[model samples]
Target: MQYIYAMMFALEEINNSSTLLPGVKLGHHIHDSCSLPAWALQAALSLVGGDMPSCNSAAKYEEEKGIGASKGDQPVPLIIGGCNSVTAQIVSRLLVPLSLPLVSYTASTPSLSDKQQFPNFFRTMASDVYQARAIAQLAIKFKWTWVGAVVANNDYGLMALKVFQEGIQRAGVCLAFVETLQRENIVSDARRAALAIQASTAKVILIVAWYTDVMELFLQLDKLNVTDRQFLASEAWSTSSDLRQSTFSHKVASGVLGVAIRSSTLPGFDTYIHNLNPLLRPNDHFLKEFWEKEFGCSPGIATASPFASLPPCNGTESLWAVNNLFTDTSQLRVTYNVYLAVYAAAHALHSLLFCPDVNSSPGHNITCSFTNQIKPIELMEQLSKVNVTTPQGEAFNFQGADITGKYDLVNWQSSPEGQVQLVLIGLVNGFDLHLNESAIQWSTGSSQVPVSICSEACPSGTRMATRKGEPICCFDCIPCADGEISNTTGSTQCVHCPSEFWSNAERTACIPRQLDFLSFNETLGITLTAVAVSGVTVTIAVFVVFLYYRQTPMVRANNSELSFLLLLSIKLCFLCSLVFIGRPSAWSCRFQQAAFGISFVLCVSCLQVKTIVVLAAFRSARPGAEALMRWFGPGQQRGSVCFFTSIQVSHYFDNLSFTPDSVHIQWLSEVYTYYISY
Candidate 1:
């Protein structure tokens, strides 16, 4: 309906402008195709003057006006109709023999690009080849690897399906299912397609069908309460009012992803649509039906024609108060195509008459001549070279067999009041696509695009491996092997670490594997140092107590010299542990090991000497043990401690003699450095 109103507006604008087509009035015989090829074929035959008698009468009238005629009169100068590709193909075949110029607004099938087949046919929209690849690219951008497809069983659907199948497969996306919906028995076909869509595992579904067929599927999906799935729509129904105007369908179509021909504001189009007077269109049956449906009122003398249930018209209804699909200017992608198509036809006629300068053609130049002798075939040649500026100052041309145009990607998002709107989220020009993901909304009302993957993504430290006989979306995650690293999620394979580095515990990253040694700042090192210092403090306190009670009987009986030697050895043991606390240098390594061994041996030897002296004194009470008890004196006990300590000292020098380089000697072979140094 918007397209029809747009065409009417464009023609009116051209006729009212005195600068363009001076002394020439352009008129048209419009017909509704009803989206059927048969109806379109009938209209095409009528455009060539409806048979021989009508043609002869027209030719006779032209002869009476003193004009030469050739091959009888050629119908109207041009035709603009057949919005769909299927209908346009049928209508173009009939109009080709008569050499009628047919300019279509939205017929975008690639099969029509052949000049031999559709030479007289041209369109204002881009071909379907671009649209199919754009759809596949959009799915890949969102990582929607698995999807379901539903196409109408027609030429347009089949051709688009083939192109899209190749495109998606090239992008590595797998189809979960492909269903078809036919125009005849649309109700049953939509139900079956809906069942297939529901049974499939894909969360995204693509529909390549007309608006009417899509409406039927929407009805079936509504019955099943399937509102959470995502949709990828074709240009055929992506911006249709039939789906956008209904509250129920809009709810189900919320967050619908699709492509549409680019559209812009047309300044006065909204006012023109709202101010349309139905009373002035008394001869238009379609306008009457629109009035009846929009206002719930019927024309006068209405009988039982299924429209009788509507309230009778009082002849006073205002179109301004009826807000309906015709008034919406928010999505005018198709309407803009119609507007440009009309201007293209008008510009071709202006060129044929050779008008100079549309802005100043009244008095600046002589008016071009026009006669009935000029044929429609000559007008088609002019249309092929038509180049004119649109009302918005944009270029409109049909120089080539097909026009390349831009497509806008829109998402249906819900408002706070539950109304849905088409939000522009991205665009495609030629083969390049630019998407702003932040502007999109999902059916679940989430700002994030819902995940449509068949499996969870593999985490870092693991690589994805294909599962046998399954789709690409289904895969396995395997952990990286030793000496390898997988730093990214969903990595295909692991990377090997360098020789000087080693993998981290999780194997997600690598770090330098230099010789590890303990430092005083670390927790383990600090703990060990505190314990050794505490042991030294206790030993010093015990030595001071014994020195204070040197003359006491108990102190004397325990041999004061041996006790002093034992306390000194214990102090040396604690002090020697500090040599291993710092980094292993030449002096620290050699002294740490030698001092620790000698100090521990001295402590044990002094204890052994004290035990033997105590037993000898007890045995001296017997008469024969007096000499043996004398030999085990304090000097003898000291000699025994010295002899044992000397053996340890000798062993330390023995290891140093063999190695010769103190720095090369590892303190605990550098492996236990972390344990012993701390």
Candidate 2:
């Protein structure tokens, strides 16, 4: 209805302009399509004269015209709209064979771009391809991986669904379910769609339907108390006044995010609506119906007896009391399309009539001559090349059969007073999509963006474990393994640490491993160092005691030299343990094991020599070992000790020559026992 008003408004502007098509007046017979394809077809049939008489053929019609040829018969050169895709498709099919140009204000299905099927079809609205791509980008940008979809059972819904499905999948977003709402059974279908939405876990829903379809579905959603889901509306009815004006729209679609056809504010459209009266537009024909609906009254009835219950309009009723959605000039996207559609037709006709030889002229040798004829085919050819700028400075042009227009990103937000209205949040043009995230309101009524993922995001230090038979978004968070790390949230795999490194407690990063040899500050190292020092002191005390008693007869009989060597070797053995007190280094690795080996050898040798001396002394007393006693002495015991010490030192030097220069320091302390055994 807004489109019709815009079209009529443009026609009036053009008719009143003395500079445009001078002395020629443009008039139209308007039809109410009632949002039905059959009604649209009926409207098209009425324009083509309904089997009355065969009008001039295309060739005969071109030979005669009021503007450029001898005045002669001609059919209506163009038809201007059924405002939706399905209706446009029906009307295009009915009027294409008759060679009538069908200029649509809002029909935007991409299939209509095929010139072969719709050669006479043209539109002032951008194709659904742009809108679908824009919507897919929106979901991807916000990381809304899982969402539901509800579409009407018609060409617009099915085509938009297919387009958006392909686009979103390419961007890695998945739909929870694609449900359909049947206009024929709106109540049942809406209920079923609402139940599907409520049952699924998706918090976002994409609605690809007309304004009326959206209204019915939202009404059902409100009744079901399903108001928490965010809705993504297609360009078809994204900024529809009908939806905005609906009573249940606020409850159901409070936080709708959608792509709307771009529009500039039209000046004075509000004043134009407010000043309308049946008395002024007596010839409008539909004026009576408008008066009846707006004022709730009859127009022609003079007496109150016929319609006593209703208020009879005095033709001075103010439309300012009505809702601003139907009166405001803001967000006139669809109305702008209608305005452009009329201009496209008027410009094409102007080119055919008066400016045939201008830059928009067709083919070779054609010139603007008053003798050149005007026809529907010629007007269509001109419309395909029509390029002009709107009064608001918007570029108006056609790319093949599709118009190039912008899509504004809009969000339905609640004002401080709790009234819901659309706020411009972004813009989408060509392939670029930008959004202002902070300005958007979510259905959750929280400051944060509403989450629509199938599962919560895996935090850092964990990797995702995808659930079987579920969407990729549905996953479990598993901590990284002992020697691995995951530093990013939602990481698919954890990385293993290097050989000499270990994962931190949180598993978010790797750190070099601590050196493992005994250190003096540790409990075991302190205990061992204390014991080793005490043993050394005790051995020194023993050596001193033995020296102090050397002059005594029992000490003199015990072989003092052997006793001194044994005490010194025991002291060296206790000191060897001190080498293991600090972090193992090259010097400690070589010295700790060699010192222990040599000390053990010297102690054993001293014990062996003492054993021989004792046996000889006892046997000699029995009178059979006199020769054995003569050979055993302190000098022999010293020689024995020296021999064992030399052997151990030689073995240590030989093993050290064959060992690698740098050993793995972690294993050095444990190799001390092996050195002794070897």
Candidate 3:
């Protein structure tokens, strides 16, 4: 009823304006669709066929002008009706053959955007494509990775669900459940959807359904006592007065974040609505019914009226005294759309009737040459190119068959009086979302945003390992392996460090490896150095003592030359062990091994020569042993020792040819074991 009033208001506003369509007056024939596609289709057929009942001012005007004298003439040039997508689609298909333009105020199905399918269909409200993307972006902005969905079985809900699913899938968000609701089975479907929502772990649920369907769902949800989860609403029922006035609105709808069609206050619309009275328009049956329903009074004393049981109307009931959907014009969203649609039609009609260059001469009087019968096809062509601005400074134009989409992000917050208040928290234009999160009132009654995810984010030093048979969002945090690093949080894989670098203890970063070598400053190296030095010192002292006692009888008997040589060789062996204690270099490594081997062989060879001389001396005491003493003289013994020592030196030099310039410190243990066995 308010929509019809808005259309009438626009028509009257245009008719009174002298600058636009100066001599022409626009009239409207309104029909009640009862929110049914069949009724809407029937009404459209009557308007196009000129067989409509003469119950409105438009029919009276047609009768006065004899516009319907011919059966072929189309009395209605255009139509603004079918507030929902299903009815809009039905009406659009019926009007296509007649080339009649059908401008809808609120039918926002994305399928209607196809120009080939709905060429003559134009709408003041944006299509559902933008609304779906806005809802998807809202979920992503809040980082709600896991959410449930409930959609109506109609074109508006199903089409929006398709688009929204596509968007969330691209963003890697997972749906915990998807439930569909049909008007025929709304009660059962709503119960099922409510149960699904209750059983799911998702803390946020998206509902893409009409006002009536959502109301039923909310009733079921309230019965189930499911008030903890937040709801994301589509534009269909985001600002629905019926839903807001529902008994369970506060319990189920509070803290709901939704996208609503952009709205603005229509100037003078409030006063115009307040002044409505059935007595002023007693012939208007719809207005009479509206008055009867609002004030609980019948307009006339007719028994055939549905409100016949009610009290008689005084014809003086004030609309301003009653606050209802009819009189409340504060957020005139759909009403403003109706106003725009009417203006658009008026502008198109003006362009078709009045041409600027029909009389070019200044002396000639400017007049329109159009007939009283305006063609529907011609009006449609003009409507396609219609562009105008509203009094509130908003630019209005059509992008293809629909206007550009712009929405207000609203939150259903609890007011101080315990009523649900639709608070404007953001704006959504195209894919861009400007949100004021600080102003948001959450369902938990706290400042913290709700968390909806399958798993927590992986911290640094770990990578995300996806769980089997689950969504990507459900993952485990696995620490990086040794020699690998994951510096960033939630890394998919760990990267191997460079050759000279190794991972730190936490495996979060790479650092240069420390050199592994025994040094003299360390405890083990110092102990080895002291032991080697002591052995060298004691051997040197023994060599000196043996040399000092060379003329003594005991020393001479013991073969003093061999004994002094043995002491010197033992001293050389002890000094060579010191070479193994410090940081190894190319020259020190080769010299250490060669010196140790050669000194060890010379010491053992001296011992053998001394034993042989002792045997020779003992044999000289026996019969016929004088020759044995001569054979094992000092020169022979010394030669034998020198020969063995020289052989060892040659072998050391031979091995040096195959050895590397610098041995790895890691191989030092193996080298020590091999030389100790020798």
Tens digits of lDDT, candidate 1, 1-678 = 666677667767877887666545555455555566786776667556643232112110100010111223433356677677887788788778888778877788888888799889888888888888899888888888888899989878888888888888876688888889988889999999888877777888889998889999999988887777889999888877669778668767678888888977787888898876656754545566777777778866433345777778897777767666678786678788878877887777766665454677454534463545467788788889987778899877774657765899888877888777777888888778888988888776788776677777789899889899988778899999988899998788999998668888898999887555567887877877887899989999999999999999999888888899899988998887676676665556677777776777787788788878878877887887978967876678778888988987887777774341443444355425423433
Q: Residue 288's C-alpha lDDT in candidate 1?
A: 66
Tell me the spans in candidate 3 whose CA falls farther than 4 Å from its real position.
53-74, 296-304, 308-315, 357-369, 518-678
Q: What is the lDDT of residue 409 in candidate 2?
A: 92
Best by lDDT: 3
Candidate 3, residues 56-95, lDDT tens digits: the string is: 3532110001111112332445788767888888888988
Measured against the true structure, the TM-scores of the candidates, in listed sequence, are: 0.65, 0.68, 0.74
Q: Mind sharing the TM-score for model 1?
A: 0.65
Task: Give the alpha-carbon lDDT of every model.
Answer: 0.75, 0.74, 0.79
List candidate 1 stretches off by more than 4 Å: 50-75, 165-171, 244-252, 278-316, 355-370, 432-436, 497-505, 509-678
| Residue pairs with backbone atoms closer than 3 Å in model 2 (clashes) | 68-370
Judged by whole-model lDDT over C-alpha atoms, candidate 3 comes out at 0.79
Stretches > 4 Å off in candidate 2: 49-75, 240-248, 296-327, 356-372, 416-418, 514-678
Query: Across residues 404-458, which tens digit of lDDT does each residue of candidate 2 receive?
Result: 6588999888888767788999998876898888888887776578779888878
Worst 10 residues of 1 by lDDT: 59-68
Q: Candidate 2: what lDDT? A: 0.74
| TM-score of candidate 2 against the unseen true structure | 0.68
Root-mean-square deviation per candidate: 15.1, 10.8, 9.9
